[model samples]
Target: MIRLLACGALATVQDRGRLGALRWGVGTAGAMDTLALAGGNLLVGNPDDAAGIEIQVPPFEIRFEVATTFAVTGADCALMLDGVPILPWTGARARAGAVLRLARRASPQAWGARSYLCVSGGIDVPVVLGSRATQLRGAIGGHQGRSLQAGDELPLGSPDLSPPVAGTGLVPPVVALPLAVDGLPALRVLPAAEYECYRPVSRAAFWGEPWRVTPQSDRYGFRLSGPTLTPLEPLELRSHGIVPGTIQVPHGGQPIVQMCDAQPSGGYPKIGTVIEADLWRLAQAPIGARIRFIETDWDGALAARDALDGWLSAARRALSYLRARSTA
Candidate 1:
């Protein structure tokens, strides 16, 4: 078990996310940066989708009730365990009552917006709708279905006594697999159903310009400030099913990129959908940061997904070998 000593808003228990409940209109509320979560889990010897704490606002502090192994990943923050510095993405063992502190990012230029804290056993939140992720909008899962607060004591699953070799870590996915456009982080976007409705100039601008992530961005969606994407004519579409990564261009001309906690359906015009493989890059994009889009086709999107899968597979194999060598 671990107790929250200090926690900022939006920090909550999350797994891969609530899946297959969209028909009931439940949004998938999971870690904003899933690659970070998975990397932390791998360091702690947990399943790829194991539940962990997603820290959006930092200065988070927690105390281990029992001796356990853990890892912190994602944001390049100042991590301290009982006053001793711990490296991000590295696994470490904590004695009982040791306090873990995560300060704000060390650098603004760092590629991180969220961080993941994964333990050997994962957080033992009740499974709701086949997931442990907190559905904040529905108030259904996670700890009381809300953000964790000070003094919250979260239960943990049975610990994996033989954790990964201590101090071992994987290279962060951001560094391992990089994607950028003109020095700005980029996401592969496939043109959506309403792509043709936009004027030729609008399409060119969407592809050529870098969009700034506005302050209004949150778990729901990223409201982007960029070239006004005007359609050749006004468009009105019936509310239709949408998923995370759907980039909707509203009447205001600013594009809104749906995120993990976005509604199941939307009525806005979608100019493009960011491929699932690159959503993590957008998730880590800081507010006020500018990012560009790379136009892609169905085949390119599939290839990107395959590349991500290959990276995860290689990480798993490497970790397994390390564990075996340690025990030998």
Candidate 2:
């Protein structure tokens, strides 16, 4: 078990996400940086979809009740264990009563919005529906179906495999992952059903210009501030099924990209949908950061998805090989 010593209201238990429930009006709310969660899980030999703690606000701390192996991934926060510095995106062992601290990111370049903390086993949370992910809107899953608070005691699942050595770690192969631009991390978007309803200029700007994520954004949606995306005419659309990454333009012309915690359906005009492969970038993108949209075809989107899958497969194999050599 681990105890939340300092962090409260900024962290929650999450898994891959509750999928296949959207048909029943449930939104899929999970870790914003799923790749980081998956990477952290793989580091500790947990299944890719295993439950872990999702840390959004930083300067967080936790104490281990029992000695165990753990990994910290996502934002490059300056992490320390009992005052000894530890590397981000790496796994390590801690003794009983060891206090783990994650300070505010030391470098401006490393200040991502979220991070993942994975233990040797995983966060032992009851699985609601088909996932352990928290659906904040419905308030029906995760740790007590709400954000964690100070003094919260979370149970740890029993490890399925041997724990890594105290210093065992792996550097994330983020370079091999998909990105829009070199450092800007462009998100590939596919035209939605109402794509053609917008003016030609609005459509062009949507693809060509950079949009800044507004402060109004949250887990449910990102209200982007950019060139007004005016529809050719006033569009009164009926409520229809919407998924994560769905970019909807309301009457105000600001494009709001629905995220993991978004409602199952919406009535706004959707000019495009950001491909799933690049949603992590958006998740990590800090407020006021500018991001570009790369218009892509269906084939390109599928290829991108394949690329992500390939990366995950290769990463798992590499970790397995390393573990074998280490054990030998």
Candidate 3:
């Protein structure tokens, strides 16, 4: 394992995100930029579920302890390998003491939000609630429940393994985010437990009005302000399990979309939910942005879920082919 010197806005290990144990009150805490994380996983042949780093904007740097290949994706950060330009969404070889830097610029992919960097070998960190993702609010997962700071060290899990720098993208990583992602998608969700209690007017308004993002949003959730929604009965429900993208409407009638860093259980009544496929874009949303929900029936949701399954299977196959070709 190489010794890593944290130089800038580095955070702890993340992956596709923590899963399964939410029933036990665990948050699906992980990388905000799921697409970028998967890109790194594909480069290194690690399963997509492996942990990586969710980096902030530019001036991101680190020193390599051992020889290995690493990849960075997400965000349009100005990237430098030993102070030279590099490309994101690609992999490169670094010897012991080699430095990596990501500087921000104007691009669409990694813009104004979370990005991901993955080492050939995953980082070895303590697991909480069966995940390495840091849940800051819980103060449980990740590296002591905080972001990485300068001078801090991270342990690489495997050191003996080395693969030649073999990838389609440039070495240091291109300082730009992927421009196209099919645009922001309308989240489709079935009504939550209290869906029936909403007045007809409030229910219609939910699918009708355009909600703008609130500045007070974070990993906890996105607070949106729009429309005047009223519950059929003004009764409060007990706090229960809340999933990522679940829309909970409180007293103001505005909606809050719970995110990766949201609490496991919430007291507010959840009116609707976001479609899972649309979540990646939502994670990158900036403040004061507009979003709308496109209502879909249960069958449509099932079709979307199945499509994702197909895509993941194809991705796994593609990775296998890449590794096999590189070795041959």
Candidate 4:
């Protein structure tokens, strides 16, 4: 068990998200930076989709009630165990009564806006609708359907093996060593159905200029502040199915990139869809950061996704092999 000594401003329990429920009007609520969640889980030998704490605020504090292995991934939130500084995306064991604290972002170069704290077997939150992730919009699932607070006692899944060595950890290459173009990280996007509705210059500017993430952004969507994109003419449509990464242009002319907690359907005009593999980059980008969008074909998008899947598979296999060797 872990005691929430001091809950941050916006920390919640999350898993791989409640998949296949969009048809039922439930958005897929999950970790913003999924790669970080998977990295933390893999470090501790837990399933990649296992439930963990998704922390957005800093100076978060927790007290371990029992000895167990844990991993911290994503943002370098200046993690310290019992007051000793520890590296992010690293694994370590905590003794009973040990206190773990996370402060503000340590550096500008670090990648991520949110940090994940994954325990060995995962947080023992009751599953709701095929997921332990918090559905904040609907106020369902995850620790009584709310964000964690001070004085809350969160249970841990039963450990089947002893804690791994303190040095065991994995560095996510996606963040530590990012792929860049012209010294700027970019997200690949596929033109959506309404792409042609926009003026030719608007479409050109979308790709040619950089967009800044506004402070109004949250889990629901990122409201971008950039060149005002104007359609060739006013258009209207009925509410239709939409998914995360769908860039919707509202009447205000700003583009909102739908996120994990976005509604299943929307009426806004979608101009493009950020490819699945590059969505993580947008999720981890800090507010006020400028992001460039790169246009890609369907084949290119598929190839990018396949490359990500390959990396995850290789990481899982490597971690599994190390575990077996250690036990042997």
Candidate 5:
């Protein structure tokens, strides 16, 4: 068990998110940076989809009620265990009553917005609709189906007796599998159903210009500030099913990228959809950050997904080998 000493406003318990719940209009409210969650889980010897804490608004502090192994990943931040600095992406053992705190990045230029804290046994949140991920909209999953607060005590699953060796870590996915455009982070986008409705210039601008993530962005969607994307003709579409990564251009001409907590259906026209493989990159893009969108096709999207799978597979194998050597 672990107790939250100070949990910022947006921190929540999440796993890989609820699958098949979209049919019931429940959005997947998983970790914003899933690669980070998976990496942290690997370090702590948990399954890839194990539940963990997604720390968005940081300065989060927690105390272990029992001795346990844990790891922190995602945004590069100042992590301290009992006031001693612990490196990001690295796993370490914490004796009972040890306090762990995470703060803003020491370096101003470090790129990332969210972080993941994974333990040897996952956070023992009850499964709802086949997932332990927090569904803040419906208020059905996670701890009370709301953001964590100070003094909240969370349970943990039974952990492996032979835990992975402390200090094991992985090269963050951002560094290991980089994707950028003109020196800026980028997300590959495939043109959507309404792509052709936009004027030629609008289409050109969408591909060529950098879009700034506005302050209005949140778990529901990223409201982007960029070139006004005027359509060739005014469009009015009926509400239709959408998913995370759908880029909707509203009446204001600004694009809104649906995120993990977005509604299942939307009425706005969609210009493009960021591929699933690059959602993690966009998830880490901080407010006021400018990012580019690389135009891609179905084949390119599939290829990118495959690359991400390969990276995870390799990490799993490498961690398994390390655990074997440590126990040998």
Candidate 6:
């Protein structure tokens, strides 16, 4: 019971994500902002990885082909349901012909990052390697492995209607600690597989200098500019499995953050892996924006991930509590 009344600049389905197919040459493509997507789904009582619409630029208008409940998260797009203002990072309901209008977000244009719209039961699409996430590089997944366009009807299949599950909201915003990003825009680095091959001076400076994100960035990879990092030797290796957080430095001596839709295998040397909890912040960084990385210990990283998991669990419990109260 999902239908598209109108299509905007860029909008498609995503979830907590796709994974475990790197050996088969598939990249995990899902919501760039996992925190936001997770919150939206919990609000509607949907699974964390439920496929949801990712709305990019504004002027997005959708007409519900059927009655359904939904939620929006991430970028604060002035959202509306049948012209009634609704919360972007909150949940709501819709009926057949219900027009959901999304205006430009209130945030600075720099934060034109991806936002999510999760419908209950998720968006029905062919599952590719235990996921419906689209990976255009491998020529598979998603709605034909590309962004959604006009006249293209996305299959929502049939959704079971359920009463709204009231719940506690997601985590409150926090003031990021100083030096939380390592240095003032300095990308952190750890020893890489070929770290020794790089000149000692380059290694010393790599983690100390700041990098600028270039305009030549997309879902496949990010191009960055910084202090030249010429290796002591022309090092090359056999193609190996690549992870989304891997920073690939091509011959140009610039770092590229392999994004969600990056290739599964690569020959480029990786300086380090972006910490799991910080990868989503990459999505909000814009062209010419300075970037810095901070190395975190295993215990610290695990604690951060576990804390988020705890919050998600609390959201579900809130729903159960609300449901019981409503029944009573």
> 19-64 in candidate 4: lDDT tens per residue?
9888789989898888888888878878766899999887689999
lDDT of 2 by residue, 191-262 (tens): 999999999999999888889999988888999998999999999989899988999999999999998888
Better of 2 and 3 by lDDT: 2
- Worst lDDT run of 10 residues, candidate 2, spans 173-182
Model 5: lowest-lDDT 10 consecutive positions: 159-168
Q: List the candidates' TM-scores in order.
A: 0.98, 0.96, 0.85, 0.96, 0.98, 0.86
lDDT of 6 by residue, 1-328 (tens): 5556567764666766677766666678887767777777767767656787777666676777777778877766688888778766556778777878777755553243667777767788888788887666665667887777755666674444343553234442121211235434333334457767777787766766677889887666778888888888887789888777788778888878887778778899877777666666676565677887666566776766676677667766876677567777
RMSD in Å for all candidates: 1.1, 1.5, 3.9, 1.6, 1.0, 3.1
Q: Model 3, range 39-158, lDDT digits (tens) per residue?
A: 676666565566788875445678887877887776656777787777766777777888987666765544446667788767667766677888776676677778777676777666
Question: Stretches of candidate 3 above 4 Å error?
Answer: 1-10, 20-24, 107-112, 159-165, 169-185
Q: Model 1, residue 214: displacement in angstroms?
A: 0.5
Candidate 4 ranges beyond 4 A from true positions: 160-164
Comparing 3 with 4 on TM-score, the higher-scoring candidate is 4
State, as a TM-score between 0 and 1, how close model 6 is to the true structure. Answer: 0.86
Across 1-328, the per-residue lDDT of candidate 1 in tens digits comes to 9999999989999999988998888888888888888888888889766899999997899999999999999878889999998899999999999999999855756668899999999999999998999879869899999999999999989866468798998889888999989999999999999999999999999999999999999989999998999999999999999999999998989999999999989999999999999999999998999999999999999999998888888888888889999999
C-alpha displacement of 8 in model 3, angstroms?
Answer: 5.5
Q: Count the backbone clashes (under 3 Å) in each candidate.
A: 0, 1, 15, 0, 0, 6
| 4 versus 6: better lDDT goes to | 4
Compared with the true structure, what per-residue lDDT tens digits does model 5 show for residues 9-82?
Answer: 88999998887887878888888888889888888988766899999887899999999999989998999999
Name every residue pair that clashes in candidate 2.
180-186
